[model samples]
Target: MSLRLFNPRVISRAALPSTSRTFIPSIRRLQDSSSDAPANPKLESIVDQIASLNLVEAADLAQLLKTKLNIQDVAMPAVAAAPAASADAAAEAEEDKPKEKTIFSVKLESIDQTAKAKVIKEVKALNPTMNLVEAKKFVESAPQVLKEGLTKEDAEKLQKALEAAGAKIVLE
Candidate 1:
C-alpha cells in the first residue's frame, strides 16, 4: 500500500543492481513536499519512490505483486478471437446474400422533335469515334442501346446527360 524509499547509504551496490541516477538526500526531503504536490500526498510519495527504482527492481516488484495478488497472465488470443469469429460470420453472410448487379446498358428511348440537334451533339460528344453524320443517324435510331456492359454509375451518368440534351433515355 505504501512505497518504501531506499536510502543510498543503507542500500549499497551489493543490495540491488539499480542503474538509476535519481537521488533524494533523505526521507525528510520527500516528507516535506513542494507546492507542486497533487491533492493526494501519498500518491506523490509512491510516484517519487517508483521513479527512483531501476528496471530490474520494478520488474521484480511487479512479478512479486502479481504472484501475491493471484493475478493470472491471460492470453491475447482469447480477446482477439471474438472479432475474427465475427468477421468469418460476416463473410459467410455475404456469400449467402444475393449478388449485386454491376453491369448496365444505356438505351435511348426517344427524342424531342425540337431538340434533335442537341441530342445528336450529345451522342457525338459521348462517342468520339463517330462522325457528325453517324451521330445524327444514331440519334434517329431511338430505343437503341447507346453503350453496353457499362458499370451502373457510368450507365446512370450517360442516361442523365442524354436526358438533359432532350433525349428520353433508360438504364438497363
Candidate 2:
C-alpha cells in the first residue's frame, strides 16, 4: 500500500482514475439527514415506539391500526398504474354484455291508393278519438309515425296489422 492512499490531502481530483465509482450514502444516513420531526409529543412518542418494534410486531401494529381506524387495505397504485391490457379487458367485458333494444316505434312509410279506405279504418281503430276526416288526412300523410314508445311485441303486432291493410309499415 502507498502513503498516497491513506493521505486524503495528497490526492487531487485529476490524480483519481476515471473508472472510480461515486460515493452513495446508505438509507440509514438519508433517514438521519431528514429535517422533518413530529411536533406533537404523542405522535413523536408513537413514532419512537414503532421504530423500536420488531418486524412481526410492526406488521401486527399496522393491522390493529387498520381495524381501529376502520381503514380498508387498498392498493392505490394498482388503479392509477393499470396496464393497457387490463383496460382493454375491461372494455371487452363491457362489450360482452347483451344490449338488445326493448322499446320500438311503429312508423307508416307509405299508404297504397287501392287500400286507402282500409288504412284509414286501421288508423281509426288505432286512435278511437280520430274522426273519419282526421283519419283520412293522417293516412294521406305517408311516412308519418302512427305510434311511439311501444314494446317490441306491440310494435311488431301493429306493423303486421298495418301491412295487412296494404300500408307500408316500419318498426324502429
Candidate closest to the true structure, highest TM-score: 2
Q: Which one is best on lDDT?
A: 2
The local distance difference test score of model 2 is 0.86
- Work out the TM-score per prediction: 0.44, 0.47
What are the root-mean-square deviations of the candidates from the true structure over C-alphas?
17.2, 15.1
Candidate 1, residues 1-172: lDDT per residue as tens digits? Answer: 9999987678764465444323334444577665465558788799889999899999988899889999988765445658988788889999999998899989999999899999999999989999999998888988789999999888888888888889999888
Model 2, span 61-172: residue lDDT tens: 9999999999998865555566887889889998999788899989999988999999999999999999999999988987899999999999999999999999999888
User: How accurate locally is residue 161 in candidate 2, as Cα lDDT from 0 to 100?
Assistant: 93
- Whole-model Cα lDDT per candidate? 0.85, 0.86
Which consecutive 10 residues in model 2 have the weakest lDDT in total?
19-28
In candidate 1, residue 58 scores what lDDT? 96
Could you give me the TM-score of model 2 versus the true structure?
0.47
Off by over 4 Å in 1: 1-98
